[model samples]
Target: IFTSTDQVVQVNGSAATGDMDVLANHTPSIEHIRPGVVEVILEYKSSLALGSGGCTNAHPVSNQHINIVEAAPPESFSPKAVSAKLHGALKVATGNGSEEEKIGSRKV
Candidate 1:
């Protein structure tokens, strides 16, 4: 989706191998990204989250193209709140909670 030269600091995405971040001057390579958050870190410390989508990085150094199957406007979240939810979900999923509770925990 990068049409112009917008100094990108880093790009984080979920690849087939694993979740990784590509920094400036990163080695040229291709990756099959899975459906997950793609965070683009800009030069001025600003960032943008491209909601869950799949992509392929043909040539990371030069022409970086992103073909998102689905997208949505980014949203902000609190780390503490997210952590709490995760902890609660884990507790329910691992503990002696009901099946319904464990199933619910699987959601965001």
Candidate 2:
């Protein structure tokens, strides 16, 4: 069984116990499944191997595709400049008032 939510794809079930091969497409099932127009692909393969004790073992292998988008760069900032601006604003807003007065004035 396969379940899809947003950009995430999940497969639940035991492939080792099945004989069928499964392949998934990269279109509506995976494309644009989330916030962004990302695409994903999933493939599963299973094989049975013979053991020395006359027993058979099943093995499963899976392949996945993940596409990630690059984020934009952030604007540059100067800590000293920001601090100076904040200090000037606080001084203008508070004047000679006490800390409690300033807090009370800003309360909603």
Candidate 3:
């Protein structure tokens, strides 16, 4: 659920093969999702690697729990750059993020 009013708030939704967007009050559905970039658009844009050792156990489970996501540590993942960038973005998101931060989110 990414939003923006004053500070840009973006989220890199599931990049997996079957990732999807489940909006509020939307009908429920099941999917076999994969792991990929989960971006959060903000003053400072960044990326992160998903899953274990560059793979996520995001296999299909239940449609009622699509909100649940899985992510691994940077040390264990291969995309170190993306992982580090994600960390930096989190810091800015929680702290004082700059409006001039890079924009990596897509235009809805």
Candidate 4:
């Protein structure tokens, strides 16, 4: 979703492993990204919401690149809808549900 030649101060992104903050001269590596905001830090910070599929390639010689499979604006989501889903998930998580259901609810 983003391509830049400007100098970056830092970048914050989430992966299946966990969240990570990348800085200039970060070690080269590849990380499988999860669905979350990828914040690019520069003179002014900017962010993009990414879908579940993507990978980050961090190289010392070149800048970090995030390959996004899907993207959507934050405004596209309805807070009320999200809240309702969360409520149901919490109920399943706390109530007498199957083990799989409880674990899945907690993940939600």
- Which candidate leads the pack in lDDT? 4
lDDT of each: 0.70, 0.34, 0.44, 0.77
> Best TM-score goes to which candidate?
4
Candidate 1 vs. true structure, TM-score: 0.55
**Residue pairs in collision within model 2:** 6-33
Name the better of 2 and 3 by lDDT: 3
Candidate 2 yields a Cα-based lDDT of: 0.34
Across 2-106, the per-residue lDDT of candidate 4 in tens digits comes to 567767777788887899888877899899988877777776766656465699888879577878788776778899997998887777867866788877766
* Stretches of model 4 off by over 4 angstroms after superposition: 48-50, 84-108
- Candidate 1 stretches with Cα past 4 Å from truth are 1-3, 58-61, 76-108
For residues 47-77, could you state the per-residue lDDT of candidate 1 as single tens digits? 5565556765646545566666765435666
lDDT of candidate 2 over 6-104, digit per residue (tens): 232332222323332224322222221122111222334322222111111222323333222331112234678968977866775867557776776
TM-score of 2: 0.22
**Poorest lDDT segment (10 consecutive residues) of candidate 3:** 53-62
By TM-score, highest first, what's the ranking? Answer: 4, 1, 3, 2
TM-score of each: 0.55, 0.22, 0.29, 0.63
Question: Which residue pairs of candidate 4 clash?
Answer: none
